[model samples]
Target: MELQQLFLEAIQNGTMEGFFKLISYFQTQSEPAYCGLASLSMVLNALSIDPGRKWKGPWRWFDESMLDCCEPLEKVKAKGISFGKVVCLAQCAGAKVEAFRSNLSTIDDFRKHVMACTASDDCHLISSYHRGLFKQTGSGHFSPIGGYHAEKDMALILDVARFKYPPHWVPLPLLWEAMNTIDEATGLHRGFVLVSKLHRAPALLYTLSCKHESWVSISKHLMDDLPVLLSSENVKDIKDVLSTLLSNLPPNFAEFIKWVAEVRRQEENGQKLSEEEKGRLAIKVRYLKKFSKLKGKKKA
Candidate 1:
């Protein structure tokens, strides 16, 4: 009853600037919920980091900037994107960032912080939460807070995992509760971070130039096999076929990518694959489907 009252009151008193921003901003994840990656990408995009650079919706490993920032080789398709990586990627994009993990001592403190932060046009906020909210079905995910209703105290979670959840008003208290948990990989409590204005670093620009071509080459290979892999029956088949193809490839190239290239060629030229080969081809296509949305997006 008390929470209900807050919602009614906040509906009348609060203003949601971030929710308004999402109409023009809010790009979905490039692959799964690289929530941290995608949310940071949104903030970076707001800061005009990539400008007009077109990003094909491929895995982060195919993007020089994102791959260089993430640690685990498998985080491209797996979970465990940490707070440190978030800070690093923001810095690389020329945004000064500060990460606050499980540090909000009180609901009012957290609320005040969020309210004040959004007041600024000079920076953007990205937050992480455990899956207790959103109907209790997901794990940790990230998104920008778009609005805050002062009377009701509901914060708009501009979920970047668009396919999974829509932008909704989560109560400030519940959202805070969701954030107060440990990331198994980092042993740090989930919380929010702020990314300030952009100013490109000389070194950051240099790194992109050096690694740009390698990523482009990687993307080409994945795109070829992507459609067929997208058509696979199940994940197990995708994994098994990719491994079989990987074993025969040269050491320098990524194993799954080589498999993907083969799948692409066979499909494009209309050659038939053995049942075993067909399964492998489908794996590439499945993962490719994951990134199709971000192809034209500069930030992901």
Candidate 2:
């Protein structure tokens, strides 16, 4: 279906709510293999997710260049991104994503997902399908589903490769067939991804670092050892538990001490903090005081 046909359907049925939001952010792929990046950037902008960095001339925006956390831009430029990489990139951008490959999902399920996405402005769907199945000029392609014409059972594809093809509607089942084909590069079927905003927790004054190398041991101790020590009836004094925990602390445990001091400084400066932040600070301060008492006892 061409733009004129899509316009006709939109005017008749009033089902272009998703399309209206997406058109404002629609972009053409900068490189031949940048379909995934372009499609993702459009959906990210449509969903109003802040890129957390400046795009150009002080504008913070999502672009093909900004999506390089999962794979290098150079590699993506050489060979287009796979479905899994697209999901990773979306997650790295802080968007909540759910991906479905045609081989792993039924066409009935895909149609239901398409209906749900096209019927609302809160979420958008990005389709990854082979163009050859649709008798198009390319192999694999990525595009956002702008709308679903239920009466006709066709889906409007906002193709990112605008230079080659205009926005068109294809039968939903045929689209599923296109996606069901295996990609020669990854030996896996293409798929669709549902993109939406990820609601984040309130800002915190202190947080644990999962990226640290010692985090594995630290997390294990917190999850496994701490419970047993707390519940053991033989452990008479809480100070004994603190001493054992302090002895097992990694060398970088001083980082937590620094955070405790920083929180105190912020409080002294009259900076208002969330209750969650205050609670975390109190816990850290109490742990530090216990460690301090244990150290004093050992020294004396």
Candidate 3:
């Protein structure tokens, strides 16, 4: 909806906290197809997420250029990013993301999410929708939902493409209809993403890998088989249990053991480690010793 046509008075009574927070960080797309990048950059800065690297000479900020970790800039420039790619980029930048495609979601469900995001100052929403439904001049576009007029049921879209259009209010049902359309690039329905700050945890020495081809079986072995094998009276020696365990693990498991040994050597050489790191290393060392014992049993 056009700015003149929208009831601006209703927005004051509705949720305006998110709108106020986002307005200061609002940015225009650098390139014609940089709507996703610009929208994400605005949300990231509004949430006070540090980019951890300098954008210009001395300033560390989130810009369209800084958001190329997930998809290369050249590719995103040639063809605009997909809904899933936006989610990936947001997550890589340490923002918590909850994405929903119109195809996989109901209008009622979308309304609830829209209301929740607009109600809080801690989160913001970015909608990916086709412009045809809005009678606009583009295909798929990305824009942040600054606020929602509850009584009017209209959402304020802070359009990143400032040259083409101004920030306007769109009706909830009409916006949902626009998002329900498919993007030719992804062959999936356009959608919206709720972006918020990720609550970080203390760094760990090691993390589980699910990228392995046999990850499903590996996880099952760790969860079910390993416990039973450890407690089994039929297991005569620890070597037998170790053998059973090692056989289930991927071949790259040895590489992890090698890495653990390297860390131990570093510690022996007077390298300082965090208490959490040291504690985790100790557990791995104990497991390594068991494997060593199993190897010695095999040699005998």
Choose the strongest candidate by lDDT. 2
TM-score, per-candidate, Cα-based: 0.57, 0.70, 0.68
| Tens-digit per-residue lDDT, 1-300, candidate 1 | 754454455435544444444446677877774777778777776654542223554311123235443355366457657767777777755567877776745567678777865555456778788876656567888888876777566787778888877777787889988888887878888888877775643221112221333555555545665445545534467577666444322233433333343443454453456796667556656655543433324233
Query: What is the Å distance of residue 237 in model 2 from its true position?
Result: 16
Question: Candidate 2, residues 20-133: lDDT per residue as tens digits?
Answer: 889999899999999999999999999988665558885768999989877889999999899999999998787899999887889999888888887788789999999998
Query: Would you list the rank order by TM-score, best first?
Result: 2, 3, 1
Off by over 4 Å in 1: 1-14, 50-67, 104-106, 199-300
Best by TM-score: 2
Q: Could you tell me which residue pairs clash in candidate 3?
A: none
Supply candidate 3's per-residue lDDT for 156: 88
Q: Lowest lDDT 10-mer window, candidate 1?
A: 202-211
Per-candidate clashes, comma-separated: 13, 0, 0
lDDT of 1: 0.62
lDDT of each: 0.62, 0.81, 0.80
Q: How many Å off is the CA of 36 in candidate 3?
A: 0.7
Model 2 worst lDDT run, 10 consecutive residues: 203-212
- Can you rank all candidates by lDDT, best first? 2, 3, 1
Off by over 4 Å in 3: 1-11, 204-300
Better of 1 and 2 by TM-score: 2
